[model samples]
Target: MSQRSEAGSDAKPGNRLTVVIAQLDFLVGDIPGNARDILEAARSAERVHGADVVVFPELCLTGYPPEDLLLRPSLDLRIQEALDQLMAAELDAAIVIGLPLREKGLLYNGAAVIDKGRITARYFKQFPPNYQVFDEKRYFAEGTEPCVVDIRGVPVGLTVCEDIWSDGPIESAVAAGAKLILNLNASPYDIGKQARRKALLERKAQANGISIVYANLVGGQDELIFDGGSLVVDQYGQVAMEAPQFSEGLYAVDFTHERHCQPVSQPLPEEPSLPHNIYSALVLGVRDYVNKNGFKSVVLGLSGGIDSALTLAIAVDALGADRVRAVMMPFRYTADMSREDASTQAKTMGVQYEVYSIEPMYDAFMQTLAEPFAGTEPDTTEENLQARIRGVILMALSNKFGAMVLTTGNKSEMAVGYSTLYGDMAGGFDALKDVPKTLVFELARYRNEISPVIPDRVISRPPSAELAPGQEDKDSLPDYAVLDQILNLYVERDYSAEAIIAEGYERADVERVTRLVDVNEYKRRQAPLGIRITERGFGKDRRYPITNGWKIGK
Candidate 1:
């Protein structure tokens, strides 16, 4: 493939600058499909939106975190073939698509600038983020030089996700005489991250004295949920256009680039509130995980608990109630209110549901264990048996119906090993695996606001597993508020137990939570893949070995 430039001197300044931000969900390692999606998006931008330029998310061709697949020599050739196909398309608009590039014996996380059947320019990402869910340093060699290419009289500066998060890339772009900055991103979703992104973009635009168009990828890839909160900010630090978070769409914004002296008058679209934002993240995460992985429907055990209720609500909202099935697995110690809440929530969500009582199975297991445990007093062993039974039934239904089982355990439970492996953890996907228990309540309230689908009693009552008689979550663990705080420090912030204690945490509470987290590494290893709404999630971010001897205080 020959590279050519369409550089022209002193092109006329056009008043209407149309930029299309393609908020797409690209599958990992699906090069052909991803290329097709990009071409289709480009066609849509040119034919439908009349856009002069279209921008895609970072690494849209090979997906983000191709992991060790970058080691394969053939992957780069495949991406090049895809890029060639895209460049050969008949679309008139300039296309900026992310793909890996091999230049001078080093691989680069790069984006190609294609216009009118030719590759004009390429921008390599400078900051290859290595911390917290990113391992770019492991694959691609970082680029030091900034790229600012001229596209149809508009000087466009190109940068990837992490580049704009810092100062150097954006500053270099402005220094290189770029009028507009196009930032491609695959930023994963976390609580309050959307707001932080907007704030940073606003600052970047104001500081650089250029309009910035931020495009982020949307979907769940294993654990990572990339919330597509793409937006355009003017030089005066004002938002011109904002795209919806956690949904896929082609959004266009017209920027008047003729010597901007006054503030841009484009109406700023309203962004979703915090609770709604979190809810949408969960919904998109569940929806993408189910649909992308070829699952027709989802099956989850409805325990009349808050975690399951929230997970069910998210699943139904994402895949619709018709595709979501809830099963009530009642046991010996299960309360009537628990059953009633589960049934009511399922009915309110309009999902298909069935009652599967586990009393008989519980009795059989107990009878079998009676001979071996006759002398010992029954503790959590009996309680865990009921949970395991419920897990078995859910998995059985999943196998029978070809549906994916959605585990409802929250991050707090998963973090502290409060959940049972081969029981509640026996599912293909976990909907709320990254969401802490405190945020779970906030999401429940948010769900009720849209339509009071989840029963108020489910949200109001204290969360309980009901594995044993009169059991509550607090009986085994600390309050969710305190627990989440400690977890945020330990997991997200990477604070030590002594550091957490120094930051006003009770020594005993910190010790207990840290110990649980350390001892439960084996269980987390067996947990299902879920949407990553946090900086540190179980599958990728937290990778502690099960047989480690490193104690917290030691």
Candidate 2:
């Protein structure tokens, strides 16, 4: 075990134990960079706060779910090398960091405690969550034992993300005489998850009679966004320190070990307003997805509708107005109000705006398809042609300017197949892909509450794609309130058609919406990646085969 040059001795009687939880954002696969970040945080904690030990989020080295990269021999070697380099640093405080470990041909999600240039103890993750976005069981072998170590004469227990979700880890640590429990995590964000986490941690602390420190990772990884709400609770289930959500920072707490550590009062930052919290989450999601993948700018089609308006607001907030560009594509059926709303919003947001009429392109397509369309009436076909033309133009801009196109369709439209396939769906990212239409209106109202960025007409007017003359969203799909309710049950809550009908929904409506959702799996498969705020999002969490024969009533 690693031993540090004694900084003298343990805490004196009635002395306080200083602990810091480093809520950091780590880029996946960036081992050297992450290691440097870990070291920097450790140094800061030791020098600035005089902390006895510092803890970081789970999988801080390789980032969370290094996915298949954990299987690569070279990556594993690099992780070990990074840990060695971290151990080589001379620091007074013991540091606990998370990484993956491969032992005897079995991989485990592990955390290591380092002090005086040596690893004192290593704890492998006991639970590998396999449901939803987690697939740890596919790659990791569950650890059977808990790790307990000494820091300045205080017995400390170590557990990875999933270990603390149950009673075993905490029970084992308390049974082993641990006075404090440090839980490392890479927990992803879902609406209302923060409250759930706090309740669980409080219960664990109260039950075990030990002060518990919880640290979680922050930032967007692919479709998953982690809101770092790292926190600390004392033996009596009182919160001592709480970090802000959706940002990276270090939070410190002082624990005095007597017969038990009584909770100390510390002024914590106020919880962010709901709109601010959700908006920040969306912005972070977009920024990380673009910057991490090396994109310079973003492009999106701006209809005179609320969906596109809100999407533009999010893009400008994420990538800055200078980095965002909007295109106005007016079709034959487009209204003058839409044109005005689109232009006004663009100018208001200070983004580069351009006008591109798809009439010329529509004429060209009609001429090309005239022979095959012999005697057929141009109905939805002509409307769809306009959408495709706009899509092609936006994609061209994306290619020429090196900007990714952002799609603006919401969950309600997506569920009812009200959106065009290659038209509105063609983009590198979808900002509102998981957000429903009702929530879209709520967000627009919330944005306006902050400042009058979106035009009043944009929020007040009925939503329409203007694909056909006098087209409104309700022309094909049901009203958003009803649609969203049906979808929340059918899609988000995973209710069957019969179950939805039993909940007072008309049988026909339930069947129509559910069938549309099932049929549109192909479209969702082709859609761009988006942030996941709900329990089950379209990306990795809800996996349905594209070509499947399963029917609801059959």
Candidate 3:
């Protein structure tokens, strides 16, 4: 979803000119619609915020990480059309907007400073991120020139997203006589990313002794979610103002030659709690993926577990109760409380829900498999039949309706192959695929803070698959708190078993968990894509060879 609206009071702190930060979300590849949003926000910044200059996020016109869309033949033409529209608008304030510039058979990620129906200055992004989910080098040439545009007689430096992450661009702009720097960003969300950005920007502000105004894009694009934690840091390394996370708006910072930047006592946004940040990221990710892809609604199995409960709440909050469907498929060992809790939560959220017992289906599958297992002891193969039965029921509902099926497995189960393949994992998307099991419970509590949707008993009860009599998660796996930490160290940080053990974890548990993760690569590869809230998610950030024979220790 793009920005809803961003009209806030314009600050006029006497000494400096007011520069508005257009903290808005832009839809990827929607050139025409994105152009309209840019124009509307530019005009509003000047008219409502009384901004002398309004700064938008990186690639505001074309959207960030446009990926292969940059390879399209008509991209250059669309960009030129957008620039022409901006020039034609004759915006009152000097508007800074990011776009891709194609010239002389070379394309550069650029930010244009427009004033008086003309392009006053242009700054190409000095650094193009090429790691992790970024592949900017594929479409853009490296920019070495420094850009400092004169806004109301003050020289303001311009830098794109990755440019500020590095040293050269900001330093180059400072050398080019910029008293203030306006950095535009489309940085994707990860746990602790906002803190890192804030600290880095503050240090840059103090080192350069230039007031920095940052504008960031907010919303979701496919698997990534960009949180709008835009900042305004004074020359003294003090935070003057900061926009709230998961919100879009036009925020302003006043600046002048006399004071460098006009000072204010604006209260800094409180640090977002872990639940708040991750939950917000997931909601935005689901909302955009669903709406942007033009899906009518979504459906999922409601197992009365913490993972599905959180997923259901997130889906309802994102698309509303009308667009979500909950299905409960119970087999022989399925508990009555599971059904009761699923019904209670579904009714509380006012979602369309149904219960279809999978007893007949399970029986049919068992009868077919009885011959194959005639001489073998019963194992996980039989237990997996139950989950596969439920998966079929949920998918059938999704097919009957047009709703997409949402798989409800968390990162912990995904890491060690604790989930059944094509059974519980059969779906269009996984809401908690990046989230650890420990965090899932936290999110359930977080959602309840807004309103009491999840039953208290659900939260307090010990988690179980209910696939067999007296089944519990801890019976087959280590405690979640212990497992999640080990998973994070190994999967996210690439820590070796020895290193994890040195950190006080038992050698046996570390070796066992890491072994499971390495062996289960094939399963995770088949799982549906989900929201990425951590630094390293399984799909994009972490890649492993499934056929490897590497072991933790001799």
Candidate 4:
């Protein structure tokens, strides 16, 4: 489990305290299964490492962000049963775990310290975050107190996820004579989130003059990815021990108390590159989504474009090449290089590859719509027919063989409604929904650095939908370098058109891009959900009225 030497039974409890961090993943709403894992981890922490206390992530019993499941009437009963099961094990070490606690008819996000077949202390979360993918205020009432307990002659304080982010709870615990504080969390991963957490912990521990232990959950929960970079910080705000990110395991730390307290030395993990962090998050997201949802395999339309090529690479990396299938749906508009690149990449990745020409399907659809389109001239309707044909063919394959269809649309296209609904957007999941066009190029290069699966030409070619002859994306959209900057200002930061234009952008470009983002709300509403990497993705992080008439001005 942990990499620490065993502190045998002869170790004195008065001078030494062994606290193990259980940085593991748990399924949401699987209370029984989660409890079993918690119990097993607790026992191993005590028996193998001789731990005095073992800390688990927030909501480890019922999982984090249970959403509407917390409103169920049986939620209280299930939580109680899980806690009772943990206590019945009668472990020698104190187990600090999190759950939704109900008291006097009000539910609170709380944690309990169970030791010697009883709950020694209970702590409720003081601050419940309500912004950006967190809706705890709707489900949990705020707790206004601090809880401190004694374990192995050390006065340890307890705090939930949001409580540690603020100063009041830790101050109260310190005032109550606590030497060490343990925080349980289910914090999700975003770009630069780990750095922010380390900074926050260092500042808080130094400010309070107390050592802190942070235990975080690891795995994918729908659109959220928990990276599990749990760690221990000394009273002087120095990182004492650090756990690996995007991994699941038990890590141990020892604390010796004299006049003050500090964690024993442990090797710190090397920081991963930015591309590595993002790629790992995507891989974990796809792997858990596929396995947990019971999908046998995944299939996608493999155009030689950068977006689809990246999606194919992620699918193959997430699930093995055998569990991934790539289909090249060619039409009259499809280029020879597109076909060649798709075939070359699929062959390099060693996945199941097939060719399905949409020419017959397009012809059949046109023949059926001839009478209804009597007065219509050829336009995007004709172009969209090719895309719809490819969508239908991919769906048919998914229906016949039971492989989940993965869509390939990046955020730059999604923000401007450059994508066609029920066409390229017709799939179950999208791994790059929050990624921008520029980031897609960077990730492709990063993957190739690991192994040269994607052909060099694919990365160097101009991006195009190829629904019509020479249909490059630049025809309808602004330069991605400009569009992504405006999007970050408008969609993520909520900047007005006038304000964005004032930021050195042209007025016409600002107006047009923001208008597309507004008018396309209905389309994005119908698109499949995907992984969230930015501060604000088009998922729960950003919610706008699809039918509103709000003007885009400062």
Candidate 5:
């Protein structure tokens, strides 16, 4: 439900400010459309909610992380046209919206305050974060000035994303006589990003004796998913207004400065469980990737393993039963239990299910290569053939039906080069790309709690590729619990082999796993793009050369 606290609801006999938190989903590179949305929302906030000011997210004009689109020759024209649209809108409520402001030679990440059909004030982003999933320094120069504008007799400060992440912007705003700071954010979500943001904002508010209004972008843009958990922290570090995560809408809060900064609002909702939050991120990432990319449906090879089962469930939840298709390909080594579980889960989820046997295809390939393999013993070539056969079939269907194929490889398998390239890794997108194997089981159980869609056996049984007879993941891999820890430290934390070994891990296991990760760069490079749920994912966060000679030191 939308919470609203109109001006004077609990304020003294003085003018109160109604600020609208426009937590909205915007498409990247849609300059004109974003401006239209801004103007439209501003109009409603003024007409319906009696809002004195409406605050939008960071980079709402060109969308967050416009990337190289900001370099387009026509970018200036588009942004100027958008500003003109807002001026033409004649919105009564002053709107604070984010956009790119190009000066003489350098471009800046900026926000503009529009009121009375004119841009009154502007604030540039002082910190252009260049770390993981952020390369703002590549495109934008750092801003140095603080902008504090008067919004109906209230001194309000403005800062873009990453500005408040540092200390200077907020402190400057306060020093410039800002009683409240409006920080625009396009901050993407990871596992525990919300908690860190709340803590940081609370401390900033409490220490500086200033109220903070944070508005974050919502929706998925490529691998990143922005959870729309917009919030307002009062001067005393009290959370006066809290918005729900993963949903987009306009939220309102009434701030009165008669005596001191005080915001009145209803009780906020609690944060979701960890698994629940991860599940929602994947779902939003999948939904937006499919819808935004113009895919009608998605298809995936639903092996009975937990990874594929979890991927299938996520696809169903993201795009719905009608938009998801599951294909079970049986080989000679494919167990009866595997086929049964795959079928049962698809039936429970109400997705279109099909079965195809790759024995004939495998036999034909083997027969063609019989002469060359006359003296050689059976090896990974045969095992990879089975996986490649399935890939060919899925790709054939995708080509014929226009359904995008979703790969089901998880982070654990991708990290160790355990998957076959162009085989299981062949797909347009991966739902579990950043998820580890152990977390895959946790999410499967979490989904069942919502409603039993995945089979219990699928979650309880041992994971296998079902390539050779009696094959299980542990046959060639360390235990998932141990391997995931090593992978996390090495891949996400960038810990060296010696550093990981010092963490009480077996030295041999650490060396072996780190070597696999290093050698598997080629595989990960060719893999499909997936949802990013962790602080470091293979897609945008971690970048390594296909050929390198760096070694870990003791």
Candidate 6:
């Protein structure tokens, strides 16, 4: 790696600049720690890589989406302290970092360029996105100007996360005589988002005829996962260099000012399959949420279903098999095949496994409620009772051993309120809360391809809660193949029932599924927060009044 320090000197020669992209992770609201990390990375960039400039991701100091933390009275004071610490270091390389800047009683999502121990330039984010998972408009006053600075005798422009999404920011920088653009991002991942980002940057770079360097943050924060696929796009819009997604490192791109700023090309990293990307996102999300929240390990109820089987594989991958525990709570309705598959996978994965029948607990609960349900026939109450008993058992183990319980419900079930309130929904984290049923099967197959950890029967068998005799998911809901398409249209695309029907889905299926989603807001509201992978998840991504009287039709 020391050879990299001489990269600039060996390049085309006249006035070469090496800018290192600091694709790193920082915990939200940890101002002091984040500042320390920034200084450490900058020092390494200068000492090891001989970098002329080190650019960090957006909001690296306070971390991205600080949310209501930005509203605290002491935010400005803490930010100032962090900046003072950075400026005092006086490192040799110019460092570009992000934070919330308070000026004249207004807060801005801003970036500061520090050169040789002093503040040289600052740029506030011009566009503060408010849709989907972003709420920047609630806290920031958008900057009205562009910032271009000189580094190593080359003109460089600065832009924050949302600025490049629109046309104005990059164009303004080009008009301001910037030969190269540096974009600091805390961009989250969705399906095929990386391709979209590269295409967008390619068009922007070609249209402006200016090279662009993108530095993105990596890691998981609550429900959000920022995949750092930092790269350099040349003036002609060709991807010159790229760092792999879901990784953290300092990637250097060399540039020489011959006629125009030209980035030295490097071999591009191979793009992973979509299943691989989604699987990696889930692993990172679960690991960070569990570890960041200070849990030692995780426990989940494995009911021999695809949802739990996939979740078990993910947990083991994220935290290792030693840190994961699987419990099987079987009732009278549970099949021998279901029990056999659960045990086989648990043993194969080498995780701690246990079985405790819910018959006694269910009997106890039913007897206690016999008088209250005097004349009521056996219905969902009995089934729900079985689920709640299993939930209580899992929660007890979690409480006793200090392991967080992982809920195993997928997005498809979450959409229609198929999950019990305190039953299967009782847990600290859910790994599949954003994954639909169809995608769940795809991931299960993908995981098996890597290594056969999950039992084949688990994937081949029909999914059931085993709360009632001979019951399956299809007994109450439509086929997953049709249901997931309806969900994607209605939940993600915001299509109305009529609009979904126009997409060729049956009107009865559309109306029933849409109504279930509408009325089940209360259930989802109480469910545990999970990793978000789709464009619209049931977390901060979607908000609706649970008591609204709005109709289902357009």
Q: Report lDDT per candidate.
A: 0.86, 0.85, 0.86, 0.89, 0.89, 0.90
Per-residue lDDT tens digits for candidate 6, residues 1-554, read 00001011123246688899999988999999999999999999988888889999999999987999999999888988999999999788889898888778888998888886777788888899999999998999989888888776777888998899897888888787788999999999988889999998899999999999999999999999999999799999999999989878989888987668989999998889999999999999999899888999999999899999999999999999999999999888999988999999999999999999988878888889999999999999898888888889899999999999999999999999999999999999999999999899999999999999888888888888888888999999999999999999999999999999998999999999999999999999999989999889998999989999899978
Per lDDT, the best of the predicted structures is: 6
Off by over 4 Å in 4: 1-14
**Which runs of model 6 end up more than 4 angstroms from their true locations?**
1-13
Each prediction's TM-score versus the true structure: 0.94, 0.96, 0.94, 0.96, 0.96, 0.97
Off by over 4 Å in 1: 1-14, 260-265
lDDT of 4 by residue, 413-529 (tens): 899998888899998999999999999999999999999989999999888998878888888888888889999999999999999999999998999999999999999999988
Clashing pairs in 6: none
lDDT, model 3, position 218: 94
Q: Write the per-residue lDDT of candidate 2 for residues 241-339, one digit (tens) a residue.
A: 888898888777888877875546588778777667777788889999989989999999998899999999999988899999999999878899989
Return the lDDT, model 6, position 396.
92
**Candidate 4 lDDT (Cα, 0 to 1):** 0.89
Better of 1 and 4 by TM-score: 4
The TM-score measured for candidate 5 stands at 0.96
Better candidate by lDDT, 2 or 6: 6
Alpha-carbon RMSD to native, per candidate: 2.6, 2.3, 4.5, 3.7, 3.9, 3.9
Model 1 per-residue lDDT tens digits across residues 306-331? 99999998898899889999999887
Point out where model 5 deviates above 4 Å. 1-13
Per-residue error at 140 for model 2, in Å? Answer: 0.8
For each of the candidates, give the backbone clash count.
0, 0, 2, 0, 0, 0
Name the 10 consecutive residues with the lowest summed lDDT in model 1.
1-10
Show the lowest summed lDDT stretch of 10 residues, model 4: 1-10
